[model samples]
Target: MSEALPQHLHSAAYFGEQRDFWWNHDYVALLARRLALDAVIDALDVGCGVGHWGRVLLPHMPRATLIGVDRERAWVAEAAARAAPFAPRATYRVGDASALPFDDASFDLVTCQTVLIHVPDVPAVLREMMRVLRPGGLLLAAEPNNLADAMNVGSARHLAPVDDRLAVVRLQMVCERGKIALGEGDNSVGEVLPGLVAAAGFAEVTCWLSDRAQMLVAPYAAPDQAAMRDDALTHYDNGHCIWSRDDTLRYYLAGGGLADGFERAWSLARDAQRADVEALRAGTYHTAGGGVQHVVAARRPQR
Candidate 1:
């Protein structure tokens, strides 16, 4: 039999094509301007999974040479391959976020996307990112308040009983807390980043919301809509909602949820997922897609 695939730090399902549409080109360009990326000559992408985040930043910072680091050797190899087109200007290495490999004051910019959510000690990672960033260099992080996204009302689930909806929300909330309690990191860490950055002694801290949304409507013909539909269907086929049932159960239990209560909540959530897929198949599903992703930016204080 073929050797089993090595398990990386995060779920394999998360690193998919859907991530490609997470931001709009124009919005990223705007962010580049707002962050003064033109001045950057050396950049570091912490926890750079497959180099996606670093690739996204390249076009906006023509003067920068990008370096990507990840704890997973597999991801580093893949990132290196993906960054081949950029050659000498881009490189990837296996490194930890809490203790980056580079020297202090090494980079003109330090950034990460959806990375902090997976780190158990966000502050430690922030300090490491800051250490390698030169004085006056930019530090940018993109993260999401996933709890809000979980609570969004889609057309298919709008008519769910209030009690049922509330149960699902409670399940997610408790699981988020449980994840943190278990040192798995926070699912909704985006909302607190600005405060954390300020407390970390960064200067000119600021935050912005991503302009991209995952709206899906009938026919689902749009490229993004099709990607969304495929993502939903993939989850349904895999017999889980956003996370695998086993993982959800572990988090729920860790968060102080009763075993019996999890059964009901999980059932409700699974039913909702099924309903979404069915609605999508019938071309009747729709949602405004108000996801809450925050882009937090700060500059290392000048000496």
Candidate 2:
């Protein structure tokens, strides 16, 4: 069985509770082996949210001294506390991603998961990661083309009416464009990170797809399925879509969604998610909503 989702405080309400359903051990092990992760002596997890990425990767790199940094003090404290059981020497600090608080060439591995999508200046963040990484150090990031994932309508098992699925997809596309246009951040940064990494002077840039899949089948026996149900419940309780309704609305309006269309689009999307939850309860729901996250890795130049 996979590890339970950490019960740590999350800074973002929408994604606060979701966990290892996507970034499981097998996937991390693959990345570790492919990238020679065991060779890393010092690894820095930038924007480490409760140290989930570190927790998943550290066991594979036994010699690594893990360092987790997040802007949220709560996350920093939680990461430190959680890592104490096995990684006693691990450290956690409050810091920014674009301006990492670390010395040049301080670590053999500098990485982040799902963090770059939220940063406006992704190149700056990559440059900082490069700066802190030692010669021949690895810079790895797991980001997603979130818009593509959002457009996956899933099989008929999850969709109540297939016709309306396209509408929801279009709505999401609009919101994504709006989100980017607002100078907030690009939600689809994963697809473009290879270029960004190469542009940042990193060599041997490569990308891989995360092997973990978020397929939810009937009876909901798996821990992942249970977690999904719980997540949907949380979203419902908070009156949020997969992303928060407030944030989605802002993005939608920014993406050129007419004020008049907001209610209809939101209603359709919310009802669809609600249907999915109901299907789960009825033991009829199934979906492969697992995002295709891009693991973009590159090596810093030898100094």
Candidate 3:
């Protein structure tokens, strides 16, 4: 959903820190509107890392009782603590996506953000969510096609050759392929979820693009921009140029990237990202990075 995750990945350090830049309040409202929150009573948030998505959607559904589930106990604890102030009726528990620890036909709404993209058997997870949904209950999954992020257009400090751009793209493709080949989840699962939802026999399947973008301008006074600045700096400190360089390299090599070309490709991509960061510091950076992020919603058929 948010990032492509390998099966072997365990650390939750980076996931817990990202916020405000991508899934902003306006975009959350857009998604909540699409879900049509008129009758939701009990809702489930799958893979709720730190409950960001649940918190964002909570204000829109005043009557809804939220229960968040994650595989990590630490995240569950963090989610509960973070949500306690505003979401009194909310609860968090450690659970897995393929086997939610809930009764069938229990929830009025079942949702996830960027969760399905990390699943190994996406259809199985969808079926499981549907099974737990009350008849006609809504199912919403927000996911992104991250390969688009690799070639995302933005104002660059230097004009590089087309070939250089192509090399970066190629490098990304290799890394993505490697991530999946190594049994890691797909980072670009958003583009495929509509069909998956329909195939699972959910009725009235629909999709909408997230209205969010990586828009940054001079002075960067907007609240979202300020959040983005903080997020970018945090990412830089964590050595993440898209995904972390360490993770990307592991996937790249697993996906069959030549050992010899890794340095040049990685250097080029990092330099490009660093250039944007420098421009941001100088108050001259402007970019609107778009990706194939989709909020696909469907409903279980009434019994």
Candidate 4:
């Protein structure tokens, strides 16, 4: 029911899709450290893929137990392998956040990172987090603030929406034929998360900003790839003809050969960001980073 993993909804475990850095980024690490997770053990990550976040967290909590859970069995297997060194200390499981198979008060820290947007039911997931967490446990939920600066639209106003490269124009024409889940909120899932966390009944809701852009060159900066990676880039290199230049062409031709096609225009927007990679990191590229995460924490209404 949740939207298919928006960040990399297209594919998963596709040779380390988002985990190519995913939650294992340096900034995310610093952010996690700032969260002071060391105070608690037996933490769980819903929607954990490849168990990469543990790379940063486990080392931080050498003495605490950590577990990563996901709906994908294959990813769970990979996550298990990644966390094997920790073994009993760290565990991986194939589970759904909406229906976790854990007993009440099973975890002292329950964390969800950029996982809610992909999911359809935010409240259901929040309740589940509460269900598994101990009475006084911490619920650490992190998502992007795509619409964080909604009022800043006028302040940072630029040129009117004229078709500059004819790319956007063409893409719009193509979109008329098929469904493209387009919306300011849709484009960037994490933009306005503070309000959502508040609504979720999370208290002590503290928020922080995270900048996750790679600054320059390959991976994060290389313009077109979903994100960056050392070995995860083979997908783009080998499938360039199939998914790159040719991929856009296929979408266009399939849509009556509209020169200004949707895929092509979207690619243009990515290209535009690459040109100003600085801006991309400067909070221009919403959704991924450059915003505040409410990271709300609340109790289960102790009785």
The regions of model 2 sitting more than 4 angstroms off are: 1-11, 14-17, 156-163
- Write model 2 residue lDDT over 1-303, tens digit each, in one string: 113433333445533445756676777888888999888899999999777788888889888898899988877877787888765658899999988988999999999988888787998999899999999999989998887777664554333456687778888889888878887778889999899999999999999998777777776678877887787777776787756777788999999999999989999988877776676677777777668799999999996
| Candidates' C-alpha lDDT | 0.87, 0.81, 0.81, 0.55
Off by over 4 Å in 3: 1-18, 21-34, 157-159
Model 4, position 10, has a per-residue lDDT of 27
Q: Predictions ranked by TM-score, top down?
A: 1, 2, 3, 4
Q: Residue by residue across 1-303, what tens digits does model 1's lDDT show?
A: 113324434656676667778899999999999888988999999999888888888988899999999988878887788788888889999899999999999998999998898889999999998899999999999999999987896998898899878888888998999899889889899989999999988999999999988888888888888888887898789876767888899999999999988888899888888888899899988998888999999999998
In model 2, residue pairs whose N, Cα or C atoms come closer than 3 Å (at least 3 residues apart or on different chains), thus clashing, are: 178-255
Tens-place lDDT digits, model 3, residues 34-59 = 67775689999999987888888888
What would the per-residue lDDT of candidate 4 be over residues 1-303, giving only the tens digit for each residue?
122333233224243444444343566557557767667778888887766655556766656788888888766776777677778887888898889989988988888666775565677788888888887777766665433422121211234244543444444344322211221112134555556666767666666654543232323444323453322234434333113454445444555655654455657644433433433345343232223443444444454
Best by TM-score: 1
Screening candidate 1 with a backbone cut-off below 3 angstroms (N, C-alpha, C), the clashing residue pairs are none
Query: Candidate 2: deviation at residue 139, Å?
Result: 0.4
Clashes of each: 0, 1, 2, 12
When 1 and 3 are scored with lDDT, the better candidate is: 1
Q: Quote each prediction's TM-score.
A: 0.95, 0.91, 0.90, 0.63
Q: How far is candidate 2 from the true structure (C-alpha RMSD, Å)?
A: 3.2
In model 4, which regions exceed 4 Å deviation? 1-34, 145-187, 217-303
